[model samples]
Target: MTRVHDMGGRFGDGAVVPEADGIPQLGDWQARALALTLAAGALGQWNIDVSRHARERLSPADYGRFSYFEKWIAALADLLVETGVLTEEDLSGQEGDAPHPLADRVLKAEAVAAVLARGGPSERPSNVASRFEVGQAVRTLRPAANRLVDGGHTRLPAYAAGARGRIVRKHGSHVLPDSNAHRLGEAPEPLYAVAFPASELWADPEAPGDEVVLDLWQSYLEPA
Candidate 1:
């Protein structure tokens, strides 16, 4: 399902602005939000996919209104509560007498650099062969009949639905976000770089010669 956050190929929003060079764009609180998110995620209660889904689940009005980091902080709080790490009272600033539930798992200040350096890797070993080969033509799955309903988190962009493309490269196998976001098993699948002409995706393409390449999974494609 298409949510407000999926802004790909949409018109009239505004021009993209590049961040100023060497200048910090975020405030201290924004930095804290990022740190808190990473720290909470380190506890193993949820994965990156789950956190992304939490942000997407925000109400449309709130999603559109809040600034970027604001959304992150809000989503983080909700996830903490939902996972039983924090209570509603904790969020409301009522200090508790009991010890923190995840105190042992707290990301330590001394190990911050090591944790950041050893980034999370999603690619997993797969014994199954890839379904499509380079130069093979394929098409993305069309959107469901009910477009407004939530269909969980997905990496497929709404604009790319039903679009025709060709496999430009293979990325081996990786965790499928559709299942991972819902706490489902990480069903690894062959990922490919599929290139689609601009004309195929847009009705009135300003630059028809250009192409858009998306890293798509095997399940998202079929013989064209």
Candidate 2:
């Protein structure tokens, strides 16, 4: 889907800003949202990729306006209902019979601090070797599909789609997020670091150091 989120090569305002002032990374509500998301994941309901797609599926307007954690919260809220774990009433603080999502393994407040410190892992073993190798020329896949109607997640960004690039490095085979997000199991695939020229994506001057290197899966690329 072509959206503002894919700002790979666009020329920005080029506004210079000061260094970090040490403000909190997340507000109170966002902190709560993160906790809920992590707690839900502990239950084995949905994977990180699914939650990512849920955020990406949001309307463009909402997506552009939402902060990073806001998107996370929205996605978590949606997934809860999608998995039949909770209903609108349950979230609204109304009395309902919806089973506690974490009834089997409740997330204690004290444990929340520890859980967030150690992030969730999603590495799957691969039985097959990677199709493409480092230094190989490749072209990205360009599909006319949107998550809202098409129903899936993709790591391929719009600007990089259909563009040719060279595989700078191979990150080895890992769980294919597209399939994992859909609950189709890991479906391991190769991941590569592809370097695309700035001119190719933005039609701008290809400075000697100006380039976009993105991590893309094997499914998104083909031999050029």
Candidate 3:
């Protein structure tokens, strides 16, 4: 199902204005939000896909109301509560200054730099072989109806759906977010970088020669 988070290529949405110097002007709370999220993720309660899906699960009103990091903090709170790491009382500041139950796995400050450098790699051994090869013409799977899609969480964007493209590069197998987010097995699939003509994605002639390339999973594409 199309949720509030899937706002790609939609019209009337304001342009994404970048910072003048292209540097992120993050506030203290926003910085804390990122650190808290990474720290909580270190506890191994859930995967990155689950974290993303959790943010998507926020109420439509909340999703729209919250800022970028605000959404992260809000979703992190819900996830912590759901995983029994924190309680409503804890969130409300009613709990005492007791040592955390999972203190053993607490991400230490000393390891932050190392942990950040050694990021969580999702590449895995594929159970199946690659289906499409590099430089193969393909088309993104169109939604059954005019509606975007019915699946809960997906990497496929609504605008890219039903568009014809060519596989420009092969990314090998990786964790499929659609399945992993919903507690399904990794179900690794071959991924490829598909390049589509600008005209196929947009009717205007502003940048017709430009191409939009997306890293798409094998299941999301077919022979065009």
Candidate 3: deviation at residue 110, Å? 0.9
State model 2's lDDT.
0.77
Please, what is the whole-model Cα lDDT of each candidate in the order they appear? 0.86, 0.77, 0.85
For model 1, what is the error of residue 119's alpha carbon versus the real structure, in angstroms, after optimal superposition?
A: 1.0
Descending-lDDT candidate ranking? 1, 3, 2
Per-residue lDDT over 1-224 for candidate 1, one digit per residue giving the tens place of the 0 to 100 score = 58888888888988778887896767899998989889888898998888998998899999999999999999999999999988899889995789876789888999889999988888999766788999999999888212222577888888999999999999989988888887777888899999999999999988968999999888888889
Better of 2 and 3 by TM-score: 3
Cα TM-score of candidate 1 = 0.93
Question: Which order, best to worst by TM-score?
Answer: 1, 3, 2
Candidate 3 RMSD computed on C-alpha atoms after optimal superposition onto the true structure: 2.8
For residues 1-224, what per-residue lDDT tens digits would candidate 3 score against the true structure? 47778787667877778667766777899998998899989998988888998999899999999998999999999999988999999999898888987989989999889889999888899987888877889999876121122456788887788999999999889988888887777878898999999888887736768998999888888899
lDDT of 1 at 21: 81
In terms of lDDT, which candidate is strongest?
Answer: 1
Q: Candidate 2, residues 1-224: lDDT per residue as tens digits?
A: 46555665566648767777887477788888877777877776777888777887777888878988888888788888898777787788885765674696776778778877877655557876788877889998876233323546777777777888999998878787777778777888778999988777676565855789999888788899
